[model samples]
Target: MIRFQLEESDREVGRFWIGFLHAFRTIFPGFGQRFLAGIVDHHQQPAPTTIAQLTNELEQKNWELILENSSLISSENWWSGFVEWLQPFKEKHSIVFLEDSGKMMRKAGEELIHGISPKLRIALTASEIWWPRWFSEEFPGENCTELWHKLRVANNIKDFSSEIILPKRNLLTSLQNQLRREDQELLIQQIRSMINWLQDQGEWLEAVRLMQNNKDFEQAGEILQDKVEDWSSSGADPLEVLFWLKELPGVLLTSKPVLCLSAAQAANKLGFNFQVSYFISAAENNLYALQHFSRNDKLWREMVLDESGTTVQGILAQITQIRIGENHETEF
Candidate 1:
């Protein structure tokens, strides 16, 4: 005989909500008929002779099927029925225990639960590869994600023990392109544009610094690679830091780096983690803002089309104004 209880906080084995559900489901078929007999056999003190008589006495419940599933339950999936805001029995959980019941358990996991209850059932699993490690500490008994990952690999190998397989996405590449193309006018435009872009991207650069200083490689990679816009399409490279790469505000020109340019020039120094979002319209306008104003919507007009008439300072002011106006508008 085994006692049954449902608890939410307790991570104890054979006492979880899932364990109770499984146990109930397992014993329900035989217990249902016994329950019916127990109800029917309600009478004045009947003969309490055999073990079977005690069984019938214990099984009776005259009321309708009040409690349905109760067998071989697990701790997982107990949260399925839990609703916090509206109180059920207690504020924490609706726990009821069964005393002195025979118990049988299913497998350690619900690997085949899908075949049983497919659509209605949601799987209880922690992420293996990408899950945060704190989850394991939160629920120590819930199978180890690390071990589970290894188990999956081991199972895969056992299924095809002799087979040696290569990855589907197997490719090899080498050789780097060695062309140095520099348009002085475009460079000036890029340098100016980046200096202004830095103003809007100060916090982002700070986040980058934090990552670099702390050696947080992943976050650094993300901040440097995330796209600024979704719709624009252009061939681009990572580590293209087009924003806010300016010298200090009050610094002398001689005290600053040798030169400042039109575009982000920090990519070569930084890893391929940062990227510059280039809008063709913005670039075109920056190149031709003062003299020609180019087309209103062309995204990629050569910025320094007429370098003499289109100075970097003017282009920076126009682009900055356009950007400010854009930011002012609610894009939502």
Candidate 2:
């Protein structure tokens, strides 16, 4: 006898399987009646003998139905009035149900895992690349995030497997272009998470470029801050930094000065000589309050002078104008 108890969490998988069975009955004449009877009779007794008898009967002829039902069930959503009837066979029939269902069930993984035995859950998840499609269709904002965490633990996956599961870069670019304004942050976070999971150092630069090309400047700034030292110290293409700086939000200059400084340095490296002073002038022009700005004056001075053979004299005039304008408004 399959020693298992139906859990509340398994309700979705249970419903899908039961629905599949309900559909299965309509196609095969006598099989439905016997399947229904087995469920009812086995439930009333709740004993090992009844379960064994039902299992034996089904095991003998069920494989034939399972093979046929495999294709038939994909087109139907027939779970009703037979959930209890199929209770005794849940564990015994789980694999046949999942195997036959294919990607059709990929969208229902959260519910599906609950209805199966723990061991079966582990087996399905441990098989690499099995859960990614399901996850892509049902995760991040669908309230199935916990299920992803669970599957990761079960499968021994140490990090989020974006490289394995994420759609290609071009697809991501298209999605970004079509995504609504309010959902931009969601896309940013997803891409940011992918960037963090990357193992190859060289790929980080490419990933940053992709984010910039997709116009995810906020995320691009994040990646720049994360890897700016490596790229700068290694003499990577400073034009990449200049490119991001061109698109980056002015508001981020005050809020994230390190990124601003990095962009300025990258621009300076490429002999865009005035970017450091330009950056400071732009920040003062756009930002009224630098109270929360965290970058120190010393770092700002260093970034302004480093290799550019330039000074912050022009930026200082812009800064004085901003302060005078703000003070005049206060007096008014």
Candidate 3:
């Protein structure tokens, strides 16, 4: 008997096996209906005599018997009877035994395992079947990568799209408490990897959002700085930059004069007169905060004497000359 059982929750999977077997039987009717009869008769009667008669009727037909959900049989006597009947035919014919629970198999006794050769025993999990179908050759098993892949596939996220952001965030929130500790750690690693990949692809705003989700504000700030710098040079959509900047924590935004300056630039570009005035004031306030720090402080020294020799004071003076209605151009 080639005995194996699929993981729990696979109620319809038996039908697939049954259909395949029925097709095979249809292809070769000369093999007779004994195998199918034995399966049906075993289920209907489940008596020792029924098994014996089925065994005797085989007469070296070279057939295999498949028992689906055999563990579901509640009678210990039936199990014993089945085992006894199989002793003589063990080497002559193949019997496939299916069970849902290994605990039930052990509770029944060692006889089930001993009666069936250890080499023929197989256990299958739901993930083994389900994950492979959707992911094909790229399935990475049950890990953070698998979860991320599933999320990406489920949301059809080919690239960074605003439509999928909320759905993906909600899905992650739902899974936070449901996943195992190791899986959660794996998910964290996957998120970090995704953030790095987004940054590499120059999807800076998307990378910052992911870092924010991970609560890696420091990294998010660094990436946001890069994004602002890139936008300033590339003349990218400034409103988009302003929107993401507003999403950042106020403390983080106010701590960096460059961030505040970028917001001011974006507002000015978009012709938001009030916002331009507000962000410019915020930039000057942050610049004032920077000026008060000890000159020896690393942040103070970096802002005052950057590699390009561009100072926050210099940028502040340049921005202050702009009127609300004029097309003001400020450089960092």
Candidate 4:
């Protein structure tokens, strides 16, 4: 019944085993008290070499202890040192242990794959194989793609959920600084596929941001356009609209006017007069810039109209009507 906490920092150092040993001592008093005393050397600590010798002795003793009392450790503590007992209980207990620890320990299941036989390895769920924290600090930068390819082939994996895809997305993300031009381009395609999957779930903005991070500016712009249109059509929050508008890479001159139009429409719907004016002014200023690069007026017009259910042309017409009315009043 001993409670153990896994600190985020504990995962980085080898002292995680020490924490487990301390907790194990609490549950089984007789064994734990003797084990801790031998390891700690009666609080009269020795020199560095002696401490190292003591640690080795502690590990050996722990093995003997785990061998005799496997039930003392819970599945949650499996990665703590209970894995050492797997040799005896592996056949009947392996899968359940793998499933439980795989989800809980974050990275232990992937490491456990190295210790077990191929048959046991194959029994692991896709989730365990592609465990979210599969990428570790010591991972070689360039070989990540090859490593994923090997895992896919070894596991006969044909499809990927977000669990698998997101890790690959992160691997591709990290490789951005280290990969060659050709390799980056190759990863861009994989990144694009995952982004597309995310978009289907209404995660357009996050996907757009990731694409922008990868410097896939063109694709990011395309997705941003779709996002602006989708948000405007759905009557999304004006503040949320502004948040995304600011995230757009300003160098995408062609998308700027279209996004501004959508934002203006969203702001107007929410009765935010200041935001509507800001976006309308932006769209008007960018129209001339859009004209220089874009030849398709029809597509530009549709971007302002179809997506928001009201056209830039319509807004201009309303202004004209007001101006004409004021002119007539002045004449009268």
RMSD of each: 27.3, 25.0, 26.2, 21.2
What does the lDDT come to for candidate 2? 0.43
Clashes of each: 30, 3, 1, 0
Can you rank all candidates by TM-score, best first? 3, 4, 2, 1
lDDT tens digits, residue span 1-332, model 1? 22333322123221232233334445453333222222111111112332244334334422111222232233345333332311333333243434212212112123322232211111111110112233243335555344334434533111122221211100000000111133334433432333234335453554453343333444443344342211012433222232222111112111211112232223222211111122323344434443355453343233342323444444456546545544565374
Error of 2 at 76 (Å): 44
Instruction: State which candidate has the highest TM-score.
Output: 3
**Poorest 10 consecutive residues by lDDT, candidate 3:** 119-128
Candidate 4 positional error at 90, Å: 54
- Give the distance in Å from residue 259's predicted Cα in candidate 3 to where it truly belongs: 1.0
Alpha-carbon deviation at 43 in model 2, angstroms = 66
lDDT of 2 by residue, 1-332 (tens): 11122211113332333344444446544443333322211112223453455456565454323322233233333333333455665555653332232333333334435553432233232212223444334243443445456545444233435544422222222223344556555555545444443424356655665565455667777766676766678866665545444444455543554555565555444444345456545555433244235276644443442232333443445445544654575598
For model 2, the run of ten residues with the poorest summed lDDT: 1-10
The residue ranges of model 2 lying beyond 4 angstroms of the native Cα positions read 1-193, 199-202, 206-216, 253-255, 283-332
Residue range 251-324, candidate 4, lDDT tens digits: 45224656666656655554445555565666677654545555677655444533546555554554445346
Off by over 4 Å in 3: 1-177, 294-309, 324-332
lDDT of each: 0.29, 0.43, 0.48, 0.44
Inter-residue clash pairs, candidate 2: 10-114, 19-78, 19-79
By lDDT, rank the candidates, best first.
3, 4, 2, 1
Model 2 error, position 287 (Å): 10
User: Residue 227 in model 2: shift from native, Å?
Assistant: 2.2
Q: How close to the true structure is residue 102 of candidate 1, measured as C-alpha lDDT?
A: 20
